[model samples]
Target: MEINLNKHISGQFNVELEQIRNDVLKMGGLVEQQLTNALNAVNNFDHDLAKQVLENDIHVNKMEVKIDEACTRIIAKRQPAASDLRLVLAIIKTITDLERIGDEAERIARVALESFNKAQQEFLVSMDNMGRKATTMLHDVLDAFARMDVDAAFEVHQSDKALDKEYEGITRQLMTYMMEDPRSIPKVMDVLWSVRSLERIGDRCQNISEYIIYFVKGKDVRHTSEDDIKENVL
Candidate 1:
């Protein structure tokens, strides 16, 4: 009889845990769409779409607040230990990352709406490519978290290095363009800001991937070597 009672309690906790996880995934879906819209706005040069992205930031902010409250309640009531605790901690951390990514997306949208002459339009092509890569990474990272796949998360970490290279190359090209045409400096500066925001979005996605890995393996892999993360996961 006692064994059955313990099992029932465990099952109940599992249900509650799954609910929280599902909510997190739902929030992730919203964030993913927000990023897509922001990138599209930039690529298409649509101020209306940019405004829409800015408006959605409010919804993302509300999700973060709700998720945090739910996590706190679960911790207080369930007193979850070990792996369960790690899951809650991970969701809390990831929500904060998602919120910040939304902020960066809004910033990108603002810069993207600026009027660009011919040369500036040409430079924006590189920015569009960079935005695509970062958005793709965010999509993959969220999928990895939903599936609780540490290997997938590791892939996201490695993918961020590509974004870093892209950012550096674009920034160098922009610097040369400014030197050649001083009149283009203002547009160049806006592109620089947008690229910086996109790069940071990639970084925040990487951080969320790390949290996913930590949730699955019970190991905090931040500041650890790539070899170490691979060894731990695989």
Candidate 2:
């Protein structure tokens, strides 16, 4: 991915920055596919696929450590200022969020191993829509990060509220099921945890989008109102 920022005169410094960004993208790709496989495992009751996703999380953790070290080295040796410093900080924050996203995906995959009855199956399937929404948000935010596109970042940030609504709806339905059939409570709770994981993944994706905005606009949009963020970016 090409960074649109100004290139430094020192070739080595530029290469170091570029490498960190590329590594972040690589980590993001792994986490994205991990989430997809985890979602598929739950939807299809594929035990082997879920196991694979769990195993692959180590790679995600490793990548996060590697990228974080790279960012630290740049900060210590190169001493980047302004946009460069923001870029490195963004990379550090993005990788941490990505790693947490990986953890959430792993949690969802674990639910696939549980035995759910036919009645509980619909609840699991109901989460598919929210899973897909979270995955799409992740994909878009990663794309925006690569291109440093503030507009795309803003759009992803705005789309998170819809995902939240979906989460709430599914949660309410699951609670109703738990109340009606006490026997299904165990399995339904499993699905509920998975649904919560997907919702958390969407939140992390939003955090990544905020990092993208911070890197490009140099504004800490965290805890800021959506309207305030819109005014800053636009």
What is the Å distance of residue 120 in model 2 from its true position?
Answer: 1.9
Cα error, candidate 1, residue 89 (Å):
0.2
Model number with the top TM-score? 2
lDDT of 2 by residue, 1-234 (tens): 588766888988888888889999999999999999999999999999999999999999999999999999999998999999999999999999999999999999999998877767888878888999999999999999899998999899999999999999999998998899898888888888888998998899999989988998889999999998877655
Error of 1 at 114 (Å): 1.3
Worst 10 residues of 1 by lDDT: 1-10
Can you give the TM-score per candidate against the true fold?
Answer: 0.93, 0.98
Model 1 C-alpha lDDT per residue in residues 1-234, reported as the tens digit of each score: 010111335687777777778888888888888888888887888899999999889999999999899899989988888777898999999999999988988888887679987767987888888988998999999888888888888899999999999999999999999999999999889889889998998999899989988877778988888888887655
Residue 3, model 2, lDDT: 81
* Candidate 1 runs further than 4 Å off: 1-11
